[model samples]
Target: MYETKKWKSKFFIVAFGQAISLLGSHGVQFALIWWLAEKTSSPLMLGISGLVAYLPMTLFSPVAGIAADRLNRKIICIVSDLSMGILAAVYAGLLFFFDLPVWTVFIMLCARGIGNTFQQPAIQSIIPQLVPSDQLVKTNGWMQLMNAGSFFLGPVIGASLYAAFPMSVVLISDIIGAALASAALAVVKVPELEKHQLEQEPIARQLKEGFTVFQADSKLFYLVLGEALCMFFYAPLSSFYPLMTSDYFNLSAMYGSAVELAFALGMMISSLMFSSVLKIKRKIRTSFIGLFGMGISAAVCGLIPPTYWGWFFFAAACVCLGASGNIHSIPLTAYIQETVAPERMGRAFSVLTLISSVTMPVGLLAASPVAEKVGVNVWFFLSGAIMIIITSILIWYSKMKRRHP
Candidate 1:
């Protein structure tokens, strides 16, 4: 049997610091959103800022992952946190001293994204080392629970802070949180892989070695491709949601926020359930089932007419979306962690992020004009239809049919 006491303490220390750090990050994110709304009041400007913030994560995750493998993983995590802390300080100081342009804010977000690209792979790769194999899923479930709580509360707290204080002060919270997280991580020791040192090979050859793991495991390969396809539908649909509310349901800011909160509630509820009550032995089967539920939810959103109950219908849809997201994501992540060699985890995850990033933007760009002509509801329906199709395909795949976690 595993020594529960030793690893349990390690996991909690890591999780505690991350929970605090994530809350602060979420607060800053929502503060920025409200700030932009007040200044430019243009959805276009907000969208552009989001794109800049996201691009680096897509572009550099693989490079970051490679670094995670090759370097001291604990140091990578600490450095990433400290890097963000420094950035937050600089930006907060700038806000205090002078009037900053909106473009500058975008640049700030881009830098943060770069830092997260490095941090994410390192963090995910280290988890296996901190906990026993039997407890990895439970640990991840708790992390997911923390994320859901942050999402539920972040915007409300952010908007309150924005109303009460200067932007500089709001940013200081993030800086402090990052500093604390880094301090906590500084004491933890992470094991380094020998394969990382076996790198007498060229950089290109090393990168190819990362890809070879997936080639050797065809089932994992197909699962990842299927996930990418699912995200193609999901990412655009998420981007389109706010507009869908305003145009179709005629929801005001209050209602929009309510719908979002309802979604968070679903994620929170599902996460708690997963953490305590649910035991998913058949992870692959669970994924398809959750996806089918998500698709049905999306289609229901489209089918609801513009009437008194439309807002209620939209809110319910958001709950379903949230429920589906948590259920689908948790198992999928556990599967990746359980399946891949620890040495290759960073590179594999980076590739997954890269694939998701590529398809989401494509879907976003493709849908706007189409939404203008065919109406947004068509896209919603289409999103649902595509997910159902993917689910069907996965179920029919004999390999997937035979698979379990």
Candidate 2:
């Protein structure tokens, strides 16, 4: 049994530690992408990099989720962080001595993605164990705030450090961050699954059980499918953010950092509103507003002129995109946490990840050629329009079901 009173303290400690690691992660990610962008200056190369970074996570989520349910969740997190730290240290050491090829970078990213595959589901599932049922939404909001803060600072710091020092220096921070994360996790006593809840079954049957649990809720199932489709458009555009700022706008990495900062700021503001001031009873409807808002904002981002003034407009749209994305994502997450059985939470989240993650890489691969040929902006415009159409149809369908039911 958990000490109810101490839940707040424990949750904050975990959140703080994760924030440190995430900050380092964001900085490293910015450095790597910017370095690659500077070196290749090709959309196709960037798309390929995104593919390598995300593919491992997508492929391994089912297994990872199973481990989270069966194994010691805290140990899984600690091992994952340590593994990533080892990878970072090795990468830093290699980069220190010699100029690593692009393939080497891809290998590093793939490994990191694999580590993340295990860490994410474990971390997400742990929250419900630590916090009370009523506080789940607030806790998730705080987590978002922590994430946004890291994102807000990471790119600017990464850009500045990369400009002054080597990429190796930026990566070293990840090792330190990882060590701290492991230390924090080690001290916390995460609850274990009861023997009855832990089924010693074959992987395929367990995987199918995960999907079946998720499929039990038809409304959430369809809504998740809708989110999956939106991701097909959103993911590629996100990977091309650097090109949109630097290549299309003919700006510097600092400008790219600023755009990212703007997005983070937007997330922070919206998270604060949702957690504190806003009382959203209708989660599904609110998520639709978020989805529809993101589509419109994305379209505006593509349509903006490639001028100094237009960059301001683009950044503004990004703020809305961030805000809307939070609105879209948080409620659904909270819904899952609230409704799903605790024993099955990890597998449930994994199923959600599987549904959402599969589309992203496909979209990246599909968009790479189109973006390379037509330009990054054209795909952004088209994706945004398609999202708008999708959202409209879903809204109508939702209304019709309400009336008919």
Candidate 3:
């Protein structure tokens, strides 16, 4: 049995802080996208903003990972949160005083991405320190629940705030969320790992070490590749889903919120199930299964009739997609924590983030043009098919490796 009392308090505190932060950040993100859409009515602009927001994660993840590995992870988390808060405040000022130009939003997104590059790896690294090995899955489940809750609440709150007050209010809320997260990190005491005595290395050398560790493990390498591919296709769904629901499905913005809420509900339900009852002996296989399910859900969602029933079907699909995807993700995360040396965990996760983020912009960029040339329905169909093919290939490859070995 794991020692619950020793670490549970810290775990809950950190989790609560993250939940609060996510709620605010996600709320602001949705509002920003809606504002852009209302202003420009351009999918291309939204895609570009999404690309800018994520590009930093691709560019800086390796370096961020190295810093997380070499420096104090707790300090990294705190500083990143504070920086994000300051940046959000800047955005609030821009929205309040100046005309909210597209370029300004893009720049702010880039700044936010920089903060994320540091925070993502640091938070993942810190989780292992806070919880026992056996509880990793449960902890991840709770994390997912928080994520789902944020998704569920953020858009609703954002829409309400945008309706009642100005965009500045939403931005101010985001700043507060970041400030609270930083404060939470300050209060918590994260135990540190013994520093590894490596020869003092150049920045490039340290960055290269992250890549080397990832490459040395074939299973992890392929897993990262799979994750990247999934993100490549799925990332655009965020940009497209709103447009699709409003344009294609002829639903209101409320419908978009409904779809998001449905997806989050699915994730929450699955996260609960995983935390309580689900167990997978082989992490890789479980991941493969989850990927397969996600693909199927996407495909089915695409086939749903574009009517009221369509919305219901889409909601169902979101639930399946979110749940199965989370189920797969939790085990993979736990496996990584178990397999990677503690010293290298931050870098390894950063490398994972780097790979995942690199291809996402390409996916988002591709989404609009593809939808323009083909139809939105066709785009959905193609995305589902590609997802299925990729998941199938990974599953086959893993099975073949096992058989041959």
Candidate 4:
């Protein structure tokens, strides 16, 4: 059994290490996205970039989750980090010596996506093992805060470094961050779950079992589906941000970074609020409000004109977008951890990841050309309006079921 008294310290150690890793990862990612936006200036190219970055994870998450359930998760984390570091080193060299082909960047993104595929499930599964059951929500909130904080700093550093130095120099931070993360994870011991009898099962069976776990609970299943839909609408927004800031507003990368920072600030603020001050009992209610809020924010972003004031308003909308996202995400994740069986939690999360993964690509593909034809901002308006409609329907249905049942 794990020692309760030492859990907090252990958790913080892991959190600190992850914060470092995330900071580097976020910084490199910002630089790459800015590069892509400047290079192509095509919504379709941006869409493809998102696909390359996410497709590997989408494809492998189920197997990765199974591995998390059966293997040593700490080892998985170490290997994934080391591999990513090595990949970054190689890419950095190419950037230093020669003009790297854009296609190669997509390949690097695919490899990075695969690393994340394995690492995320392992890290998420480890959380319940470390924290007390009662404190799971607060702990998840803290995790979000750490992530948002890292992202908050990442853009500032990335923007400054990108403006001053070569891409190769910015990449060195990832190598160092990954090394530190590996070292930190190496020393900290994570408690392992007892082996399940299902260990004898084949991969296909295990994969199917992950899906069946949710089938047993209809509400949980639908909740996952509802969130999946929200992600579908939200996926395009990720690709559109740089475009909106640059092409639509005719702003510089600094302005784009400011918009990102605003979103991160909102995330940090909401994370602190929900994790500490607000003990929300009805998490579903909070999720509904979050969903509605995100829709409103997106619509408002679309409506903003191409003016200095418009850019400021756009940044403000992104802040609302970020806060609402956390409000929706944190509660639902906590609820899953609270309700799902400990042994099957990895698979549960994998299933959730898998569904979201499937929808995201489709969302990107469907929106890319259309956004290219119409204005990027116009798509944002339409997506947000549709999201509101969907949320309203879900809310009405949820209430009806409650009343009748």
Q: List the residue pairs that clash in candidate 3.
A: none
What TM-score fits each model?
0.87, 0.97, 0.95, 0.97
Each prediction's Cα RMSD? 3.3, 1.3, 2.0, 1.4
User: What's the ranking of the predictions by lDDT, best on top?
Assistant: 2, 4, 3, 1
lDDT of 3 at 278: 73
Better of 1 and 3 by lDDT: 3
Per-model lDDT = 0.74, 0.86, 0.80, 0.85
In candidate 4, what are the lDDT values of residues 118-139, reduced to their tens digit? 8887888888888887887788
Model 3, 77-191: lDDT tens per residue? 8888889889889878877898765668888889999999999999998888888988888888888888888878988888778777888778987888888888877888888
Q: In model 1, where do residues sit more than 4 Å from their true spots?
A: 1-3, 37-43, 195-198, 240-256, 305-309, 370-378, 398-405
Which residue ranges in model 3 land beyond 4 Å of their true spot?
1-4
TM-score of model number 1: 0.87
How many clashes does each candidate structure show, in the order listed? 0, 0, 0, 0
Tell me the tens digit of each residue's lDDT in model 1 across 138-171. Answer: 7788878877787777656666677789999999
Cα lDDT for residue 21, candidate 2: 88
